[model samples]
Target: MTTVTARPRAGRDPMRLPVPRRVRLGLLVVHIVATAAWIGLDVALAVLVFVPMLDASWTAVCHQVLPLLFWPLLTTALLSLVSGTALGLVTRWGLVRHWWVAVKLVMNLLLVTLIVVLLGPGLADAGRHGRALAAGLPDVGEVPRLFMPPSVSITLLVLATVLSVWKPRGRVRKT
Candidate 1:
């Protein structure tokens, strides 16, 4: 059973919450840490994807290393998403209150969705190809496809980071 209260459209105190300050801070910390980790892993993946293009031997190393990273990156993405959403709900920054926050939310969701649906399978296939190449199997396909999403995602995450810090104006108007 739950009780519903009418929330004022414009005058609601964003900080009026059942959550404590430290808890909110903890969530923010976790969100930041996870986001940073996610970004770092993506950047590393981008580099690994490029390394083989420079030195053929790196292909074996990349394949051996990349598969091990899948779980950590996935965990970080999920943590950042959950913690960020919780922060938005609990703090003055309502989910859709400000344009930047809304954009961040949408972008983050897209990134996470891409990670789960597109990037995972693509990387797995890339790893398989890399392994085959390492074993002297001829004619592995272009590796660029494996790198594209993370490259784009890195750019997207950077934009999101900028939005978080800048927090430009333009709040959504209430009806």
Candidate 2:
């Protein structure tokens, strides 16, 4: 005679059941939303604000172009970082397990630092002083090269995104 074995639940996997299903799903959704925000903000800032400022005239200095953009960029970066960190810590992507997450965290921190410490002030200053400096210059280029930092910052941000996605092999993983 054969005997039938009892099951734990109706539709649950008995083995390989570590983390709770709800927690896993919550983390996944949060990460997905955060990633989308980062990508969207990055693209919009690059194409809309920075690109136009490539040739912004002095008359357009106080046009609320770059100043209007800083908030969005800041918001996107902050949200993405916070949510991503939440996922990494709560889920299996913790620093010890997934080195990629660690690298991304570092990069995101660096980006934030640069913006807060360096770029944000500079942009504000440029917006404030640009009009006076460019007051009477008939030539277009006299407005000052405002586009330089934005270009660099935007490009670096894009690169950071790529690194997050590609997640190249880091030093810790080879061993």
* lDDT tens digits, residue span 1-175, model 2: 9999987676544432357778778766776676566566555545544544566552345423455656766777787677677666565446435566666777778777766776676556545554444565343343334555556655665675676678776534645
The C-alpha TM-scores of every prediction are: 0.86, 0.60
Please identify model 2 stretches exceeding 4 Å from their true place: 1-20, 47-63, 129-175
lDDT of 1 by residue, 7-40 (tens): 7668668454558889999999999999999999
Worst 10 residues of 2 by lDDT: 137-146
For each candidate in turn, give its C-alpha RMSD to the true structure in angstroms.
4.0, 7.9
lDDT of each: 0.83, 0.60
Worst 10 residues of 1 by lDDT: 9-18
Q: How accurate is candidate 1 locally (lDDT)?
A: 0.83
